[model samples]
Target: MRHKCRIAQLGLPADQRKALLRNLTTELIRHGQITISQARAKALRKEVERIITLAKDGSLASRRQALGYVYDKKLVHVLFAQAPERYGNRNGGYTRIIRTVNRRGDNAKMAVIELV
Candidate 1:
């Protein structure tokens, strides 16, 4: 019935999807904000939030865990360095997604996901 399945496949195979999300995570950490397809932004939110949560922990294990998803060592270092200071007082909701205009090529709904 397709019920209770929450992970969006994004029409890509496992490896490609993982790679896409990893790159997206790295970029978002590096740039502090990024524009992407609405569906991907929605799907990426969960992982991004989780990574931030891990970063908030500010532990070696948490850093390792974030590194697993965010491939770039430098970006991962930045994430760990900034996450706690940025979000230490807050509980969650570290990122905000704002809807934007349709993409010109495919008319896909676009959104900007930025660190809050």
Candidate 2:
């Protein structure tokens, strides 16, 4: 029956999807860039944008919420504490997707997701 179900499965169950997004969010925030498939990059872009929108405020609640996903206090520190100042005045579109050559073996499309 699987009708009108539009949520992306991401080839993972709920808990695993949360964990996967959490880890991806952390690395993207910390390193400023990560490489992956187009589907994941798009999905992860949403999560990263959500957190960054919250970060623009620099409030305790936003910090806590970001921490809920980010997990690492240090990363949260850099995310909310520093990023706001750096990205202040900007009104969203905080990430970028740079396409790359296909992966050697699997021949999968590769993309570099980075924070702007």
Candidate 3:
């Protein structure tokens, strides 16, 4: 029984699942938004939030910790050096997920994950 589990697997194995979540989080941070399948967005949301929370800390260790999850070095640099300033005054709830029409290929639900 998958009782109270937090992750959204999106049918991927463990390593792939981790990579998907990490890449999506990096993209979302760089773009301030991203469009993807619903399950992916749901899975990536917590990770995105966690990184932003880390950004809020504004410590060197926190920046390095965040870099561990975000793959793009440029994007990671921007997040640590700039994003925190953009979102400095706010608390949490940095990301927003909006459901969109289902994808035509396989009828998978789609959603746009963005920052507010």
What is candidate 3's lDDT per residue for 1-116, written digit by digit as tens? Answer: 88998667789999988987887887787778888988888778888888988888879898899878888877777777776688888888888899999999999999999988
Tell how far residue 102 is off in model 2, in angstroms: 1.2
TM-score of each: 0.92, 0.91, 0.89
TM-score head-to-head 2 vs 3, winner: 2
Worst 10 residues of 2 by lDDT: 77-86
Q: Which regions of candidate 1 are displaced past 4 Å? A: none
Compose the digit string of candidate 2's lDDT tens values, residues 1-116: 76998667789999999899989988898899999987789889989999999888899999899888897888888777777787897888999999999989999888999989
What are the runs in model 2 whose C-alpha is more than 4 Å off?
1-4
Computed on alpha carbons, the lDDT of every model, listed in order, comes to: 0.89, 0.88, 0.84
Ranking by lDDT: 1, 2, 3
- Ordered from best to worst TM-score, the candidate numbers read 1, 2, 3
Stronger candidate by TM-score (1 vs 3): 1
lDDT of 3: 0.84
- The 10 consecutive residues of candidate 1 with the worst lDDT sum are 75-84
> Over the full model, what C-alpha lDDT does candidate 2 score relative to the true structure?
0.88
**Model 3, residue 54: displacement in angstroms?**
1.0
